[model samples]
Each structure stands twice: as C-alpha cells, then as structure tokens.
Target chain A: MSLSPLAIVLLAVTLLLGVGFYGLLVARNLIKLIVVLQILAKAAMLAFVAAGYGQEHMGLAQSMVAMVIVADTVVAVIALALAVQVRRHYGTLDVRKLTTLRG
Target chain B: MALWTSSLHPFLWLIVIPVLASPVVYLAGRLAGAALARWLALIALIVTCAPCVLAAQELAANGAATFTLGLVQLQFDGLSLLLAGLALGLGTSVTLFSNAYMRGETGEEKYYAALLAMIGVMVGLGCANDLFNLWVWFEAMAVSSYMLVAFYRDQPASLEAGVKYLVQSAAGSVLVLLGIAAVFGATGQLSLASIADSVRQAGATQATSAGLLAAGALMTVGFGVKAALVPLHTWLPDAHSQAPSGISAMLSGVVIEAGLIALLRAVSALLGEGDAVARFGQLLLLFAALNMMLGNLLALKQTQVKRMLAFSSLSHMGYMLLGFGVAAYTGQSAAAQGGMFHMLSHGLMKGLAFLAAGALLYTLYVAKGAHGPLMVNDLNGAARRYPLAALALGVAVLGLAGLPPLVGFMSKWQIFVGGFQAGDTLVALLVIFAALNSVLSLAYYAPLVNAMYRREPSHAVRLGAAMPPTMIVPLVVMSILVIALGVWPTLIAWLTEPAGQALLAGW
Candidate 1:
C-alpha cells in the first residue's frame, strides 16, 4: 500500500522522537544526550516543513524552519559550552555522575 | 490626548526598545562599569515602559486599538499594558538592585545584557499577536535566561542548573514548535484572530477537533514545562537556587508568568469554546489541582531559602493556573481576570522576596567576605544587623502567605471569587483547597518571618558596612507598589477587567 506524504513524515517523526527520547532517557554521556535532543528538534523542524509543503505555505514554513534553526544552534552552542563546563567541574561527561544539587 | 502619531505604538516599543538596547547596555557596562550598566539597563527598562504608560493613557482617553506590523500583532489594550508594565517596571527594579548585589562580580556586563534582553523578549511575548511569534519570543526569553542562570558558570552548581534549565526548556520549545506546526497544518492559520476564526468555522469536525486537541495538549505541556507546573518542574529549583539573586527574581517573577500568558493566549485564541477546548480545560484543572497540592507539599521540604522560594513559586503558579483553568473550563471572564491579576501581583511580591534573598546573601558576604547556599536559618536574627533587609524579607513573606494590606491578598481573593463565580461546584471546591493551600503556605513562611524577627544572631551580620543604596531603593520601591496595588484594588481591576474582556471577547 502506498502511504501518503503526511503518513511518511509522521512515521519519520515518530521514529526520530522515539530514538531521541530513548537516548535522552538512557544516554549516560551528556554530549550524546544533547545530540539526541538535537535530533528531536530536527524532527519538529521537519514537521513544520512537511505540514506546509502542498500549498502556498512553503515559504512561511521554510522561513520558520530557518529561524528555528538559528534558535536550535544557539541552544547547541550554549549546551556545548555547558557540557564543557560540566566535564571540567565533574571530571566526566556522565549524566549519572552529575547529581550535586539535591534536596 | 495624542500619544500616537500613527508611527508610535506602545506594543511595538515595549518589545523593540529593550531588544535593540541590550547590546548597548552591555557595551555601556563594559565601558563605564557594572554600575553604569545597571543604571543604563534601569533607564532602558523605564524608557521601554514609557510606551506602555502612553498606551494605557491612550486606551483610557480614546479606546482599545490594535496595531500590526508584518508577522507581529499586538493589542494596546489593558491586558498587554498591565503585563508590559509589570515586566518593565520589575525589570527596572531588578536591574537597579543587581548593581549593588553583584558588585565587583565578574561577567556582570553580560548579566545586564541577558537580563535586559529577556525583558524585551518577554514583552514581545506579551504583545505577540500570533502564536508563531509568541513561540519565537518565548524561546528567545528561554535562551537569554539560560545565560543568566549560568551567570556564575564557573560554579559547578550554577553550570549544572543552567544545563538542566536549558535542556528541559529546549525540549519544551521543540514541543511548542511542533504544536504550532500542527495548528498551522490543521487550520492553515497562524495569526490569533485567524486561528480563532478557523476553529470557529470548523467547529465539531472530527479532523479539526482532533488536531486542535492534539495542539492544545502539546502546547499546554510545552508551556507547562516553562511555567514550572508540577510534573515538569524539576529544573526550577536548581536554576533558581544557582542563579544570582537578581536573575532569580526575574526567573521566578516574570519568566514563568510570561509562559502562562502565552499559554492562555494560545488557548483563548485557537480553541474557542469547542468541546476540545473544554476537554483541555478539564485537563488543565486537574493539573492545577495537582500543582497546588503537591507544589506546596514539596516546598515544605526544601531547606535552601531560594530553592524553597522556587518551589513556592511553583505553588503560586498552581494558583494562577487554577484561575486560568477555571476560566478555560467555564469560559468565565472573571476567572481570566483573576488569573492575569494573580500573575501581576505574584510578579511583584516574588520579585521582592527573591531580591531580599539576594540582599541577605550579600549582607552575609559583606560580613564574612564569602557566601554559600542561603538557608532560612542563615537569616536568623538578621533583623538586628540589617533591619531593612530583614524587614523587606518579612514583608515579602507575609505578602506571599496572603496577608492583607498587600497585593497578594487582593489578587488571591479575586482568584477564588472568580473561581466561585464560574458557578461550578468542583471549581469552587478547588478554590477552597487553593485558599487552604494559601494557609498551608503560611506554615513554611511563618517560621522565616519569625526567624527574621525573633531569633538570636546565628550568623554574624555587619552593623555598619555602608549599605548599598542601589539595592535598597529597588526593594523599597517594589514594597511600596505591592502595598499600593493592594490598597487600590480598583486600579488593578481597571487593568484586569479590560484584559479579561479582550480574552472573553474571543469566546
């Protein structure tokens, strides 16, 4: 059976989101976790484009994606800097070990 | 009578002024010093507020007006002005206080920059006429505040908190983007008016209702993460406790409230009294009840004064959500008004409390030349040494606990009355629980007040070390407004009613 473009895009989103969330939940390395988060963001960005592909909405969707790209990049840059700081402070990039602030 | 010459609109200026001026404030701080940066940011915020004040005047004199530029649309109505006033007004106060609180601290120029930038972004979110623009402004606020949270990045705790805040909020942003994409997909509209129109047109259609429900759920979760609602609030304690007190004030006072405003705007605009909207509202009521119950219960266990305040902030958000949830569920304008009013007053009182927390820590640093996590016990007998700081803290605590003669009591009272007026027994019961939660909150806050006045000197506090006038001035100003708004409830009602009407008009 041939699938619609919406179905294809949604299937891809589910796959990417499933993987990203799995990594976010299971990844021990902070850097890898951030990378997974980026994948999740990419999925959303992709959805924005796919939702607007058919009609006269492509340009607006593309511009929105571009803006979201800039925002995601800023988050990445800061996340990387924070990762470095975390590594320096905790002596590891391990999420399991980064538990200093507790009740 | 003529504040607008066609080119000038307060909604545009409210967002534009701070955003364009943030880098200049940073540069000024760099050139002259943190002190100058502080004054410049204060001036920038006050200047930014001029448009809102003018807009309010114009609205009073003429009537409600709408302005649009490209993708951005804003209402120069009472709601936007009230939120803008709180943001810029508190922004000015917080900036003034930070200069003295962060005296001689490194990277302060950047702090002023990020702080000022956040004010602009939040103001943008306030007046943002479209859901897409709202998400963009909200994300900008999140990113700037991430930097502010890690202002002390060298400290491991601060960096950790910053990272946690960034990661969680970034995820939430992605969800918000997805929700917007879904909204645009289903309705083919992004503007608030258009979205509302489309949803109204497609009322009761299975495909349309499904998409709206999904969008509502996704957006609610997204904004809930940012608003520090019960389940998604793990990041807030760390972020608030680690950020310098000046930043903490903004984070607790306005940022979360901004998230609430955006959520309410989206729900009001897009969901438009559909079955889906009512379902969403029910879910929100459930979340609000949980937020109020568990938020206060959890806050009781936090020892770090700032973290405790952070949890208290979470609990207050629950109360605000209770009002909003009731409004959405019952479509009551009064409930919406109460929710918005709660947002404004909470911003004022919590800003005061967090600023006082900063000053107490600063006083400790002054006496001992160092500081660490500020505990409630750390503030013991501080009244003897720093009477003003202790008194400020005491007043903030009482106000937060819903003591009368303060803005907090008036807002809380209205929130419940609005809930009961929703004419739903469950909502009325929830409001009663919320009222009891207020009393429950006083349990934790009371000891802190007593500690300030009744306890002996546990930690050494300086008797005379040249108190920082910059910090004290802002505290005094905020305290006066807190009481001023309380005594003159009509002033706030004048603002809240029109805003409530704007949202109610959607229904």
Candidate 2:
C-alpha cells in the first residue's frame, strides 16, 4: 500500500524518535547524548511540519516547527556549554562516575 | 473605549514583561558589580511578577482569556494563573535571596544573569496555552536550568550533574516534541483544544489510537525524567544535591514543576473524554504509586541533607501524580481541583525548603570560612547559632511533612479526599502511605531541627554577621505563608478552583 506524505513523515519521525531514545538510553558520552537529543528534536519538528500537509491555509505548522528548531538550537548550545564545563571539571563524560550526590 | 484601552490585554503583559526583562537583566550585568546585577535581576522579576499577578486577578475576575500569537493562541486561565503565580512568587523571592546568597562567590554575574533568564522562561512556560508554545518555553527553561546547574564551573560534581541533567532533559524534550508531531500529523492542528477535538472525533482506529498512545507514553516518560518520577528519576538527586544552594532551590522548587505542568496539560487534552486516555491514566496511576513508594524509601537512607530533599522531592512528585491519577481516572471536579492545588502548594513549600536549606548552608559557610565540600555533620547544633534560620528550616520541614497548621497538610488533604472520592482504592491506599511517608519524612526533617537545637555546638554552627537580610527575608516570608495557607486554605482553593475549571472547561 502506498503511504501518504504525512504517513511517510510520521514513519520517519517514529524512526528518529526510536533511534534518539535508544541512543539516549545507551549512550554514555555527554556530547553524543546531546547530538542524539538534537536528532530527536528534529524528528519532532519534521512530524509537526508534515502534520500540516494538504491544508490550504497559512504555514502555521511550518512556523511553529521553525520556532521549535530555534528553541532546540538554543538548548543544544547551552547544553554544550555545560558539557564543556563538565569535561573540564570531571575530566570525563561517563554518567556513572558522577555520583557525588547520593543521599 | 477609553476604559478598555486603559487596561491592556492582561495576557500580552504577562508574556511581554518577561521577554522584555530578560535582555535587561543580561545587559545590566555588564554595567555594574554584583550588587547592581542582583538589583537588576530583582527588578526584572518584580516587573515579570506584576503581569502574572494581574493576569491571575483577571483570571479570577473575568475568567480565562485567550490572545493569539499568529496562529497559535496564548491563554491566561486559572491553571496558568496558579502556575504563573507560584513561578513568579518563587522567582521573586529566590532572586532576592540569590542576590545576597551569591555575593563574594566567583563568577557571580553569570550566575545571576542565567538565573534571571531561567525565571523568564519558567514564567512563560506557565503562561503558555498552546501545545507548540508550551514546548518552546519548556525548552527555554531547560537550557537555562543546564547553565545554572553548571554555574560552579570549578566543581567536578556540579559540572557532572549539569551534563547529566542536560543530556536527560534534552532527550525528554525530543520525546515530547515527537509526540506533539505525531498528534499534529493525525489531527492537522497544533492547538491543544483542536488536537483533543480531532482525536475525539477520529474514534479509536488501530493506527491513530496506537500512535496517540505511543506518543502519550513517550511524552509521559520524557516529562517523567524532569518530574523526577521513579525509574527515570536517577538524575534528580545528583543534579539537585550538587548545584549551588541558590540554584538548587530554583531547580527543586520551580524548574521541575514546569515539566509536571506540561505533562498534565498534555494528559488532560489527550484523555479529556476517551477510553484510550483512561487506559493511559491507569498507566500513570501505577507509575505514581511506584514513584511514591520508591522516592520516600530511598530518602530514608540518605545521609546528605540536599540529597535527602532531592529524594523527598521525588516522593512529592508522586503525590502530585496522585492528584493527576485521580483527575485522569474519574475526571471528578474535586480531583482536578486537588491536582492543581497540590501543584501550587508544592511549588511554594518545596521552594521554601530549598531556600531555607540554602540559608543554613550560607550561615555554615560564613562561620567555617571554608570554600568547598561542606558535609551534613558540619551542621550539628546550628539552631543556637542561627535561631532565625533554624526557625525557617523548622517551618519549611514541618510544612513539607504535611503537619497540620501548615500548607502541606492542607494540600495533601485535598488530594487524599479527592483520591478516595474518585473511588481509587489503591490510590487512596497510596495516599495513606503518602501521609505516613510525610510522617516518616519528619524523621529526616526532625534531625536538622534537632541538630540545630539540641546537639553540641560545632564551630561551623556559629552565626556570622555576613548573612544577608535579602536571603533571610524571603525564607521568613515563605515560612509565614506556609502557616497562613494552612490556617486559611480557602485562599489557595479559591485560586486553584478556577484554574482547575479552566483546565476542564473545553472538555
């Protein structure tokens, strides 16, 4: 069966989310985690843009997705800055070793 | 026409004030020393608070109002009002406290500036009405939070917690975004109300139903990471316990609530009137129960004060979940009311606890003249030295443990009664367990009080003249409000009722 454009976009988004989440769960490096999160954000935006397909009205979905992209970029930048600090201080990005906060 | 013109759109001011003030706070940092930076942050927050208070008043008086931002709409409803008020109130108090709290610390400017920006983002998230808009503000809040977490750049643990928090939060945002995308794909709408309407009309097709359920689950887990719910809550104790005390207060007190509100909004829209949503609610109930049990049980074993509070926060999140579970399962008016009430009350109470803790830490730092690695035992016999700070701590803990004549008990009562009224026997049992957990919480809380009051004086327990009034005043104010709300819960109920009504209005 042929899929609609929306369906294809939806499937791609599903893949992206799945991959991103898998990477998030399995990845131990802070930088790689950030990259996966960015990918995940893009997937969500793609799904959003695709949802507005076939509508004759204004590009509401497009603009909203654009806004989300901008927000994600900002978050990524800040996360990277924090990660840089972590690397400098901790000398490594492995999450398991950062357990100085147990009660 | 003049009368109407004189009163600007309440929603407009709510959004604009924070957006406008963020840059000013950032710019002000460059012009002056830490003193000016603190004042600027405080003024910016005060300005931000004005609009939120007005919007809340308008919500109380005229009901929920919607203002369009392009195709997306921004609404100032009772829920918005309640969340915004808590965010702003805590934001203002914390700004004041941090002003003095961060004095003499290295890199103070960046700390205050980032904190001010975070407050703006949090207030915006609280006020945002549409799904897409909520996501934008939520990300904004996350970014700022990551910065604050890593503010102490020299501390390895602080940096580590910041990285962990960022990675986890970023992943969660992605999941939420994908869920939003899926809902948009199915419904062709980004507005929460429109999405709910389309989902309701589409009925339960295998693909659509599955897609929505998957999306909902993804969003729930995504947000669960931020809410510090169990299983996904691993980051919280590390993040909250390692950050600078002022930043810790903001993180525990207000930042996590942003995620919780987002999840609640999404769940309410998805499950407003559907069996699928109801099933989803059941899943949430199970998660809530597990979170409640694990969070408190874990806290009992912690030796660190900050880490203990972190675990207690996890338990509190479970209590908030109890409110959400009842509301979702039965959608009873009282249950919904209880959920919103708990959100408001928890925000204030938790914010107070963290700030008071920060004040105690500050006093300890001044007395010891030490720069780093302060331990819990360092706080032995603190009460005789800093009676006022100890009083603040006592009130905050008592309130947190849900003792009567304090706000915590009032909020818990609403949630417990609502849970029982909804006939969720398991949840009611969980609520009872939660109440007992509060009593057990006293075990942990009482020590700080007892250590301060009864233990032999340690050198670190002595007071210093350097403890600033700015920090002291906010803690005292919050402590007083905790008691005031307990004696007169109607004040909070009045605010929460309209917000709950607004949440359920379209449904």
Candidate 3:
C-alpha cells in the first residue's frame, strides 16, 4: 500500500501547482501575485527534476533547473520593478484600480 | 531531398550579432548620443539580416539547413527563414520609424536596447530546434517585451498594461515549462525530432497516453496566451494599445505570430499516432472561430484607433489559425502554406497600419497640440493634410479586411482554397464562416477609411505637423509589397511553399 518516492515527489509538485494557481486567482496585490508566480516556478522546477529523475537523467534535470531558476528570477525582478512603478503611479497596490484603458 | 548546402553557420551569426551588440547600442546612446545609438540599432538590425539572407539562400538551395552550434541546435528551413526574415524586416522598419517618432523621448537607450534584444531572441525562436532551447528563447523575448511594454513608466495605462502582460505571460511560460516537463517525462527526449519519433514508435494515442495529451493541452493553452488566442487574449488589447506605436507594430505584427509558430512547432512534434493531430486541429478551429467573431464584434465598439487595431489583430490571428487548423486537420501542406503566407501578409499589412496610425498620432501630438492618444474620430478628413498617411492607412485597413486587390485577400483565398481542398464538410463550412467574418471586419475598417477621406476635418487633424519622411518611407515600402504580393503571390512561392512543406513534413 506504500507509494513510491516518485509518486511522493509528483504529489508534492501537483499540490504546489494547485496552491500557486489558487493564489493567482484570489490575490489582488501585485507583490502577492509575484509570490504566486514564484511558487508556480518552484512547481515547474520540481517537476523538471522529478521527470529527469524518472528517466535517470539527473544531470540534465539539474542543469535545466539552474536555467529555470535564473529565468524565474529575472521574471520576479521585472515584476517587482513594475510593481513599484505601479504603486507610485496609481497610488495603490490593487490590480482592480487599473481600469484606465477601458474597451 | 538536398537542394543546396552551406558550411557557413549563419544561425549563430543570426542570433549572436544583435544580442551581443544590443548593450553596445545602449552604451553608444549614453556616451555618444541617442541619434548615434538609434542609427546603430538600425545598422545592427540591418547587419543581422545578412545572416538571414545567407540562410535563406542555403534553404533555397538545400531545402533545409540543420546544424549544431556548440550545445544548441538550430535549423534554417522555409519556416524558420520566413519567420527570421519577417522579424528582421519588421524590426528594421520599426527602428527607422522610431527614429522620428521617439525623437527627444526619455530613456531612448533602454528602448533601443530592449528592442534589439527582442528582435534577436525572435530570430533565435525561429531557428530553435530543441524544445528547451525554444523555451529559453521565448522567455528571453517575453522578458525584453515586458520592458518595452512598460517603456513609458509615468503613464499609468502603460504600467498597468505592462504588469498585466507580465503576469499573464509569465504564467503562460510556466505552463509551457511544465508541459515541457511532462513531454520530457513521457518521451525521455527534448529534441523535437526525437520526441516525435518516440511518440510515433510507441503509437501513443490520446486514450493510451494521458500524459502526452495533457502535455499537449497544457502547451496549447500556454502558448495560446502569447498567440493571443481568444479567451487568453485579454492582455493583448491593453498592451498593444498602450505601448509606443513602433513597439505596438512589432507586438501586433510579428510577436503574436511568433507565438503561434512556437505553438505550431510544439504541436507538430506531438502529431503522430492516432487522432492526436485531428483533435488538436479541432481545438484550434474552435478557438479560431471564436477569435474571429469576438475580435470583430468587440472592435466595433472601440473609440480609440489603436485599440481597434489591437482587437482587429486578434481576428487576423483567427484567420491565420484557421489556415493552420485546416492544415493540421487534413494533413495537407496547402492550408499550412496559406497560413504561412497569411502570417507574412498580416505582418506586413498590420505593421503598416499601426505605423501609419502612429504617424498620424505623432503629428497630432506635435502640430495639433493634442495631449492624449488618437481616436478614430480624429481621422476626420485626415487625408487633406496627411495624404500619404491616410492613403497608407486606407490600403492597410482594406488589405486587412481581405479586399481582393491586396495581399490579405490572396492569403485568405489561399486558406479558403486549402480548406475546400481538404474535402471535409465541417472544414468547408468553417471556410464559409471565415469568409463571412472577413466581411464583418470591414464594418469598422470601412468607417475608419471613410472618416479619413469623406468627412469634414476634425479639430485634431485641422493643422497637424508635416508627416516625417522616416515614417512615410516604411509605409510606402510595405504598401507596395502588399499590393505587389497580392498581384503576384508567385513571387513569394519560394518562401511560402517551402515553409508550409517543412511544417507538414515535420521535424
């Protein structure tokens, strides 16, 4: 009745993805949204490593994880910078107020 | 199958030159002058075209070019070369137009640098042969674009659009990465060719392998955001309308199409064993139909000129998707060729439309002393003052509406013909539906044209600045190509035929 290590890892990854998506759906603050994105990246990175482990290609998986980390960080940095600008210009951190460009 | 061969590894040259030189352009702006940096950026884009042309030549002679540069794999077939050439061509025009449009604007260095970087990665995306490599290039392009989209940080609209775009696009890329993970897990390979071979050898079907189907669905929705497919296209209208006009042209013209191509590549790799491709094509067609209807319907209510164009871009994406869907469904090269040609046509036509609109906006700001974005009403009798801009805009809108004398019509015709050639009842009906949608788009396009030439001068157009030659030249060039290509599409057969064949022939 015991699950394998791979199953355990995959379950964790799925849980992370679900939580991250839930945060995205509910969170309004830009910073929290960015945190959610980071959470999602963790899931993706974990999945990559687990997939590599499943295939016995740990080296490839690790290198892919490294690249994802760098790319994910760049996204965070940009998102945070934009968030700062958003707060300054709009005078609020809520995304609901960004309705200037209405259809 | 070999038609030609070249030892020159132009793919490396294509990617490395602009990417490596982008910072140099930024430095020159800081140390030398914005003018120097601007011209340098233009020169850098022009120089990058050399490798593209050489690769095109190689593709012409050899039918395809695949080579490994260090650890990264690259190729120059019809499909890759067409995309590279389109990006470079659009990049050159945008850079040239910005010289006049962005004059005296702050942060000119960062603008040019990010623009060049985006172009570089777009070229890389075209040439990428590995799935992970494609993802990296896509992320690089998306990152550079987020910077460009928020270029006017003081403007709240720009900042909002930038953040929205950043979040949606970031989420989409993460989805794509997860899909790649699932794909690698299923096939144990990352190169597209190997993945396809493995999937085929295993005879994987939707019912047989839930993992691969899940991967395909995830990638579709992931890439769909960037491609601006309906339901995932919320960020596009805002981002395209708020960014500077040159960037707007790039975003509308080539960037979204690049997303579609990336999706096409990924999906093509998954197109083996059972009804996988057919199911994917059915999904594409559903999106295509929605994109056409909703895009045109919403566009009818927009007061802003750029917003209208942005919405219209979604509809155009629909047409191109229809072509690809038909191609995928029938396993024929005809519809895909039609789709490829439509990409080329739409890239030129829409780029010209946005640029022409941009010229009018620039003049409105400079001469008429306007403070905000241009509205369609602002174009009332614009032809009397800015004749060339008005004419260019007219040609662009009409072409986009698929009038018979323009390149848009020819491409749409090709797609319809492709659909009919499929001999599938539903696909044929979809072709009819698409034709009706094309006519529906003119509901707005025609009015814009009428406002330009048929109405009394609006206050905004009464005394606008003389249209700059830098802006006029690109519109003239693109307009000419649109007409000439429509009249003689055979001229581009070398590009379109090979590209469509490459997509159908698979990795």
Best by TM-score: 3
Model 3 chain B, TM? 0.96
Residues B1-507, model 3: lDDT tens digits: 232343557766777888988999999999998999999999998888888788778777777777765555787777887888888999999999999888777889889999999988998898888888999999999999998999888889999999999999999999999988888877778888888888788866564367777788889989999999999999999999989999999999999999999999987787675477888888889999999998999999998999999999999999999999988888767899999999999999999999999999999873344347789998999999999899999999999999978999999999999999999999999999999998989999999999999658998787677888999999899989989998998798888898898888772
Model 2 has fnat of 0.86
Candidate 2 chain B weakest ten by summed lDDT: B366-375
Please tell me how candidate 3 rates in CAPRI terms.
high
Candidate 3 residue B212 Cα shift, in angstroms, is: 1.0
Q: Residue B292's C-alpha lDDT in candidate 2?
A: 75
Worst 10 residues of 1 chain B by lDDT: B458-467
Q: What tens digits encode model 3's per-residue C-alpha lDDT throughout A42-99?
A: 9999999989988898888898999999999999999999999999999998988888
lDDT for residue B505 in candidate 3, whole number 0-100? 79
Query: Per-residue lDDT tens digits of candidate 2, residues B1-507?
Result: 443354457666655666566666666766666677778778877777666667667776877787664566777777777767777788888888887677777767677777767776676686676777888888878877777787777778777777778777777777777777666655566688777787777775677666677778877887777887778888898888878777777788777777887887775576537565566567767777887778888887877777878888888888877777777777767767877777787878778878877887777773344545445566677677777777887887778888889988888889888888877677677777777777878877777667767668776665444567888899889888989999999887767898678765644
Clashes in each model (backbone N, CA, C under 3 Å)? Answer: 0, 5, 3
The superposed Cα distance between candidate 2 and the true structure at residue B129, in angstroms, equals 2.3
The fnat scores of all predictions, in order, read 0.59, 0.86, 0.76
Off by over 4 Å in 2: A2-9, A53-58, B1-7, B202-206, B366-374, B463-466
